[model samples]
Target: MRDKIESSLESAIFNSRWLLAPFYLLLILGILALFVKMLKEVAGLFHILMTGEGNLIIAILGMVDVTLVANLLLIVVFSGYENFISKLDVAHNSVDKPSWMGKVSYADLKLKLIGSIVAISAIDLLKAFVNIQSTDQTQLAWQIGIHLTFVVSGVLFAVMDRIAFGGKH
Candidate 1:
């Protein structure tokens, strides 16, 4: 009876990974929301083109930032699901399956996530610089500081991952 109870407890614990499924599903919804935002940004770009008043580079940067964030969410959804929840068995035979889908270990996911953040931060900083005429000097300083922090954090994450994985990734 004790052995049976223990077995049942372990089974329940293992099945709890499914609880994360709802979170991943929510991420998909977040991606859809981002799509709407990207469309709005595109419309803004068109307005700028028609009026020739807004800075094209800044508008372009806004779109790029949105795209990067969307990509980050997608990476998290796919890799996090595979790493924590279950295999995306439906994509196993799909020709459009991402190359990194099944292979991104948790460590790899961490690295990729940080890398994406750093890239997004850099783009935002670039936008600030491109609009330097109106950008607040103090805010620009903070942006630079924040971007550098991200860059340094990403480097440290990579180094530690290398040490932990013996340079295998």
Candidate 2:
């Protein structure tokens, strides 16, 4: 009777992981919202270009930033689902499937996440520099500090992951 109870408890705990499924679905909703935001940004960029008023390069940078974030979300959604929930049973020869979908381990996911954040931060810093004349000195300093923090954190994460995984990932 004790063994049966223990087995039932273990099963319940393991099945609790399904609770995260809804959270991943919410990430998909966020991705959809980001797509809408990207479309709006594109429309604004075209308007700025047509008016020949605002800085076009900065506008382009904004679009790039949004795109990077969306890509990050996609990576997280795909990798998190596969790693934490269950393996996605895609056709081996399906061209539409991403090459790295099933291959990203949890460590790989962390690395990818940090790398994407660094890229996004760099883009934001570049945008700040492009608009330096209007940007406050304190704000710029804070941005630089935050970006450097992200860079350092990413490097540390990679180094630790390499040590832990023997660089296999």
Candidate 3:
């Protein structure tokens, strides 16, 4: 019957969301790689400090940049999984769980993503400014332009989300 065939097709389409689970798992691997890179950077920072060859501020900025990226990845992993896959059944009293884990809607995820991008861009811009003497004028201009673009885009996203959600979120 047409109704039976339609029901089967609907079920198949609904179950297709599971296909996204593997992609999220791959993101976990990417996070592991980022952790390794952060460890290397930390070791390099210590070496520079001991040898007295590198600028301390620049080294610290590098660490901050990595930390921001890790935080962004965490947000994406937790919120993306919850929003797309299924709810995480963590203990209500568990201290290890993030309070915002179950609450970020897709629109909220977009806002968080743009905010992280802006923060990362700002950090890079600050790094460039700190080493301004060594950076070419064109390169500096481009960095500034790119950073401004990110800021503007973030603002626009926030505005649109507010309008779409009636500022309820």
Off by over 4 Å in 3: none
TM-score of 3: 0.95
Q: Pick the winner on TM-score between candidates 1 and 2.
A: 1
Give per-residue CA lDDT, model 1, range 58-146, as digits (tens). Answer: 99999999999999999999999899888889988899998988999998898899999999999999999998999999999999999
- Candidate 2 per-residue lDDT, tens place, 120-155, comes to 999999999999999999999999999999999999
Error of 3 at 125 (Å): 0.8
- Poorest 10 consecutive residues of model 1 by lDDT? 160-169
Candidate 1 Cα deviation (angstroms), residue 97: 1.1
Ordered by TM-score, highest first, the candidates read 1, 2, 3
- Which stretches in model 2 have alpha-carbon errors above 4 Å? none
Residue 152's lDDT within candidate 3 is 95
| Whole-model Cα lDDT of every candidate shown, in order | 0.94, 0.92, 0.87
- C-alpha root-mean-square deviation, each candidate: 0.9, 1.1, 1.2
Q: TM-score, each model?
A: 0.97, 0.96, 0.95
Error of 3 at 130 (Å): 0.8
Model 1 RMSD, rounded to 1 decimal: 0.9
Instruction: State which candidate has the highest lDDT.
Output: 1
lDDT of 3: 0.87
